[model samples]
Target: MTETFQISPEQAEMYEAKYVPAIFAQWAPLLLDAAHVTTGQRVLDVACGTGILARSAADRVGPSGAVTGLDLNEGMLTVARRLAPDVEWRHGDAADLPFEPDSYDAVLCQSGLMFFPDPDQTLREMRRVCRPGGTVGVQVYASLGSQPAYGPWVELVARHAGPEATRLLSTYWAHGDLDELGRRFDTAGLVVEDVHTRLGTVRWASADEMVQVEIEGSPLIDRISDAQYTAIRNESRELLGEYRTDTGLQAPIGAHLVIARQR
Candidate 1:
C-alpha cells in the first residue's frame, strides 16, 4: 500500500495559483535543461507539485515520449490532474517509489528534496528507476540566509508566531550546503556530473500577498493568529522595502542544482 500525504484543497489551489507562477515555474526549465530532457524520452518528475515540471517535460518530450508526476500529496495531485489531464499523476511516498527498476530515461526533482523524511533514500529510489547512464536532476534552495526576502520573513514570523512557525518556513531552504548534498548523491551511488547554483526572482503583488501565500498556502495555514499576521505584514513592509518594485515584492532567490547520472 502507498502512503498518502495530506494537504488541504484550498492550500493546494493556492499553491497552483500563486506559488507555481511566482517560484516553481521559473526553475522547471533549469531542471529540464540539466537533465537534458529531449524528444521521445521517458521522464519522471519526483515530488512534482501541481505538475509544472511534468507538464513542462511533457511539452519537451511531445506525444511520442511519456511523462509521469508522482507526489505524496493527493490534493496537489488533484490540482495537477485538473490542470493537465494528459500527464499521468500518482500519489506515493518519495522515499519509496512504486515504479519498477530502470523505468525512466531521466528523473527530476525540484525544490522537494529537503522536505523528504529520508532524502538519501529518495535519491536512491530516483536513481533506481532511472536507466543506467540516464540523468537524475535535483534542486533545493541554497539556504535561508542566501534567499532574499524569505529569510527576513521567517525571522519576523519567529518573532510573532514563535519557533515552530519559523521552522516550517525555514524548511524550504534546508539541505543547502553543496558538499553535504553531494555526499547524499554519492551515498545513493549516483555519479555527480555537475553542481552549481541557479537564481530566480520571486514577485508578489504586495508584501501582504507574499506573506499570505507563504503562510496560508503552506502547512502554516491556521497555525498563525490574526494578530500575528498583522505584525508580520507591518514589519515586512519596512523590512523587505528594498525588494519592492512597481510590480510587487520582488527579490532574488537561489537554489543549488545537481545533475547526477545513474551508474
Candidate 2:
C-alpha cells in the first residue's frame, strides 16, 4: 500500500537548517558535474530546498545562463530567495511544472524525486520542459541499509513515533538501484544514461552533537510530543554510540546519481 506523507512548515525549516542543507552541499558539485551544466545553459532545479543545488548551478552557469528554482514549500523558497536572489524562484509541484516545453537546457533534482507522490508523473513533466538533448539529473539516497547514521535515526524515531515515523522516514530514504530508476525514466520517455553511486559522510563532535542535530534539525523530532522527545533523543544517542570514534562520530551515507536524457 502507498503511504500517506505530510511535512509541516516548521519541520521543513528544521530540515533545511540541519542534515538536508549540509548533505546537499556535500553532493552539489557531483550533481552539477553529472548534469554537465555549461557556462551558458539554462537550468531548472525542481524541489530546490534552500537553493543549495540551484545556487550552485547558478554559479556554474554564470551571468550568461539563467537558473530557475521551483518548490512546493514557501518557507524553502524564502530561504532560497534570500540566498540566491538573482535566480528565479517559483512555488510549484514537481508533478506539474509551469514552464513551457523545451524551456530548460538541463534540469536538476537533488534528493527530491523519492518524496514525490507520483515520481513518474514528475519525471514526465521534467521531460516535457527540458529541451531536446538536454539532460535530466536526479540524486536519491542509495538506501537506508547503506547509511549507518540514518539507520539509527530511523530506529529511534520509529520506536517513539510508532506509525507516524514510518510515514516521515519513507519520504526521505531510498536505495540507488538502476533498474528501478531506469524503469521510472522509461515511463517518462527519458533514457537513462548513467547511474553513479557516491559515498558521503556525516560527522559530529560527539553522540550528543548528533542527537542535537536530529532533535533540532529533523522534522521527525517535532512530530513527537515533548514527553517522548527525551526518550527519542536517548535512544538515538545510544544508536549513534556504536559509530563513535576518537575523532568524532562518523556515519556512512550513500546516494545514487541518476542522469537521463529525453528520448
Candidate 3:
C-alpha cells in the first residue's frame, strides 16, 4: 500500500489545538520581521497550516492589506478557515501555486517547504508571485543533531514503533542544511538576504501528552501496531523522563529563518 502523508480533519484539529500553539506559532513573527512586512502590503502564506502564521500576518498587515493562505490539505485549510474566516484560505499545492506573477508584496512559508515534493519549484513559485523588490521568507527546522532529544526519540521509536514510524516523525528535520537552503533561493532567482537562526522553546504538559498528541496527529497513526504503541509508550516514558521539568517538559527547538528579495 502507498504511504499516506496527508492528515485528516481529526488530526488537523488535534495539531492546531495542541502542537501549533506549542511549537509553530513562535516562529511566525521571526519570518514577518525578517521579511519587513508592513501595513497595507499584500501577503501570501504558502502551505499555511491552520493559519497560525497567516493569522499573525493578517494582524500585522491590518485590514487594509490582504492576506491569503494556501495549503494542499483540505483538513488543514478547514482548521485555518475556522480560525480566520475573514482571511482568504485557498486549497492548493506549493509546487503549483495558482497565482499570477508579481501578485503579492510578500510571500512566506513557515515550516512548510520541508514537506513539499519539489522545494525548488515551490521556491520559484514563491518568487514568481512576489513583485519586484518584494520579500519572500522560508522557515524550517534546524538539524536533528542540534536537537538532542529527537535523536533518542528516533532511536526509541525504531526499537519499538518500527523504522517507518521513525522516518514519518523525522520529516520535519529534512531541510536542515543552511547552505543548501540558500542555494535553493539563489536557484529560484530570489536575491540573497538575511538568514537568522532562532531558538524557540516548546513546553508541553508532560512527556506522555507530547508523544500522545504527536502519535495521534501524525501520519504514523495507522502505520504502527497497538503492540508497538504500547512498547513505544513504555519505552518513551522512561526515555523522556529526563526532559520533564517542574512545570512541564521544556524543549529547545531551533529553526532557520531565511529572508530573500524577489528580483
Candidate 4:
C-alpha cells in the first residue's frame, strides 16, 4: 500500500507543541549559523514546517531583512502564521518555488529535504532563488543506525507494527548518505561548502511520551493500531532502559547540516 507523508492541522499543532521542542528547534540555530545568516539579509525558508527556522531566521536578520516561509502543507503554514504573524508564510511546493530568480540572500530547508519527492529539483529551486554570493543550507537526520535510540525504536515498531508503519517512520532519515546529498547539490549547480554532523539530545518525559510523539506528532498517528502502540510502549520501557535518566529518556541524535553556495 502507498503511504501518505502529510500531517493534519491537529498533528501539526502537536508537532509544534511536542516534536519541535524535543527535536527540530535545536537544529534551527545550528543551521542558521552554518548558512551564516546575518542582519539585513533576505532569507527564504522552504518547507518551513510551522516556521521554526523562519522565526529563528527573522531574529537573525532583524527588522531590516525579510524572511518568507513556504510549504506545501497548509496545516503547517496555518500553525506557523498563528505563531509569528509578522513573517511572510506562503503555501507552495518546494520543487517549484513561486519566486523570481535571485530573490534571496540565503535559502534554508531544515529537516524537510527528506520528504520532497524531487529533492534535486527542490535544491535547484533553492539555488535559483538565491542571489550570487548567497548561501543555501539544508539539514537532515543521519541514518537510523547512527541515531542511538531511534534505530532500535524503529526495529521494535517494524517487528510489532509491520512494514508499512516502519516505512513511514523511516522517511525522515531516508537520505543519510553525505556523498549522495552532496551529489544532489552539485547536480543542482550549487557548490558544496561544508557538510558536517551535529549532535543533540532528544529527551522525552517518559517512555509513553516518547512513543506518543512517534505516533501523534507525525503521519503515523492514524496508521498505528492501539495494540501496536501498546506493544511499542511496553517494549520501550525495557528496550530503551539504558538511555533513560532521572529526568527522562535522553538519547544522542545526530543530523547532517549541509551549507552550499550558488555556482
Candidate 5:
C-alpha cells in the first residue's frame, strides 16, 4: 500500500499552500539565478511539487520562453496544473524523464532530487535531457545539525517515532554528503561548477505556528500519533522558545545548492 503522506493529493495541497510558500519558496530565485535562467530559455523543473520553482522559472523565462514541470506524483501534478495551467505539467519519474535527449536548455530540480529512488539514475536522466553546455541545478537541505532549530526538533520526534523518524529526517537532511554528491554527478556525466551552502530564514509568529505547519504540512505526520504530536508540540514550545518574540520568530535554514554542467 502507498503511504498517505507523499501519495495523497490532499496532503500535497496542504504542503504546497502552507509549508512550500512559507518555507521553501524563498530559494526559488536563488536556484533560478544559479542556472542563469533568462528570458526565452526552455527550462524543465523535475519533480516540481506544487510548481513553486516551475512557476518561478516561468516568470523568469517570460512569454517567449517555456517551462515544463514534471513529477511522478499525480497528486502533485494535479495541484501544479491547477495553479499554473499555462506551464506544461507532466506526470513522470526523475529516474526517467519523458522528454527527448538534449531537449531543455536548463534543468532545475529544487529540493526534489533527494527523494528519488536512485539519485544516480535521476542525475543521468536530468543530464541526458539537457542540451550540452546547459546547466542542471539542484537543491537539498543542509544536514540537520547545520540547520537552525532542527536538531532538537528532530530529536524530539525521534524520541517518539523511532526508526521512521530517522527516515523522515533522511528526506530533509538528504544529500548532506557533498563528497558523495559530487561523485554521483561525475558518474552522471556532469561536471560540478560550484557547490555551496546558502542560508534561508524560516519565520513564524510563534512556536505554536511552527508546530502547526510542521505537523499539518509535513509528510512525517503520517508516522506521528496524536499523543506523539501533542508531546512534540509541547516540547517545541519550550525548545524553540528562544525564537519566539513579540513580532515573529526567524530560524536560519541552510541548503546545499549544486550547479553542474552537462559535459
Candidate 6:
C-alpha cells in the first residue's frame, strides 16, 4: 500500500538540521560523478533535500550551468535557497515537475526516489524534463541486508510500528536491484546506461548522537507517541552499542547510483 506523503515545515527543518549533513557527505560526490554534470549544462534536482546535491551541482556547473532544485517542502527549499542562492529552488512534486519537456541537460536525485508515492510516475516526470541524450541519475539506499547501520533501526521500528513500517524502512522503489532499475528505465522510456554501488560509513560520536539524529528527523519518530519514542530510543541505544569503535560510532551504509539516458 502507498502511504501518504506530507512534509511540514518543522519536519523539513528537523531533517535538514539533523540528518542531511551526514547524508550529503555520503552521497553528493557519487551523485555528481554519476550525473556527469558539466560547466554549461542545465540540470534539475528533484526532491532536493537541503540542496546538498543541488548546491554541489551548481558549483560544478559554475556560472554558465544553471541548476533548479524542486521539492515539495518549502522549509527544505528555504534552506536550499539560503545555502545556494545562485541556484533556483522551487516548490514542486516529483510526480509532476513544473517544467517544460526536454528542459534539462541532466537530472539528479539523491536519496529521494524511494520516498515518492508513485516511483514510476516520478521517473516519467524526470524523463519528460530531460532532453534526448541527457542523463537522469538516481541515488537510493541499498537493502538493509547490506547496510548494518540502518538494519537495527528498521528492526526497532518494525517491532514497534508493525508491517506498515516496511514502507518507511525499505527502499520501496526498485533501487537496490539492477534488473528492477532496468525495467523501470524501459517503462519510463529511458535507457539504463550504468548501475553502480558505493560504500560509505555514517559516523556518530556516540549512540546518543545517533539516537538524537533519528528522533529529530526520522518519520519513525513522527509516528510514535512519547512513550513509544522513548522505548525505541532505549532499544536503539542498546542495539547500537555493539558497533561502537575507537574512531567513533560508525556503521556501514551502502547506496546504488543508477544512470539512465532519455531514449
Q: What is the C-alpha local distance difference test score of each model?
A: 0.88, 0.81, 0.86, 0.88, 0.84, 0.80
Give the residue spans of candidate 6 off by over 4 A. Answer: 1-14, 152-168, 171-174, 209-239, 245-248
Residue-level lDDT of model 4, residues 29-138, one tens digit each, is 99999999999999999999899999999999999999999988889989999999999999888988999999999999998888787889899999999998899999
- Please give the TM-score that candidate 6 achieves against the real structure: 0.83
**TM-scores, one per candidate:** 0.88, 0.80, 0.86, 0.88, 0.86, 0.83
- Point out the worst 10-residue segment of candidate 2 by lDDT: 1-10
Residues 1-263 of candidate 3 have per-residue lDDT tens digits of 11226888888999898889789989988899988988999999998989998999999999899999998888998889888899999988888888999999999999888778788998999999999999999889987767667777777877776677767787788888888888889999998789898888887898777778778868887888889888877887788888788998877778999889998
- Measured with C-alpha atoms, the lDDT of residue 11 in candidate 5 is 73
For model 2, what is the error of residue 256's alpha carbon versus the real structure, in angstroms, after optimal superposition?
0.6
Cα error, candidate 5, residue 126 (Å): 0.2
Q: What is the lDDT of residue 81 in candidate 5?
A: 88
Clashing pairs in 3: none
List ranges where model 5 is wrong by over 4 Å.
1-10, 159-164, 212-231
How many pairs of residues collide in model 4? 0
lDDT tens digits, residue span 146-238, model 2: 666786577667787786775666555653566778888998999889888988877677777766665565577767788787787677667
Please report the candidate that would top lDDT against the real structure. 4
lDDT (Cα, tens digit) per residue for candidate 5, span 1-263: 11223567887799787678668899899999888899999999998988999999999999999999988788898889889999999977788789999999999898887777688998999999999999998998888776777767778778877857756656668787788888999999999998878988787878888777666656788877899889988888888888776878777788988999988
Clashes of 3: 0
Output the better candidate (2/6) by TM-score.
6
Which window of ten consecutive residues has the lowest lDDT sum in model 4? 1-10
lDDT at position 139, candidate 3 = 89
**TM-score for candidate 5, residues paired by index:** 0.86
Model 6 per-residue lDDT at 129: 96
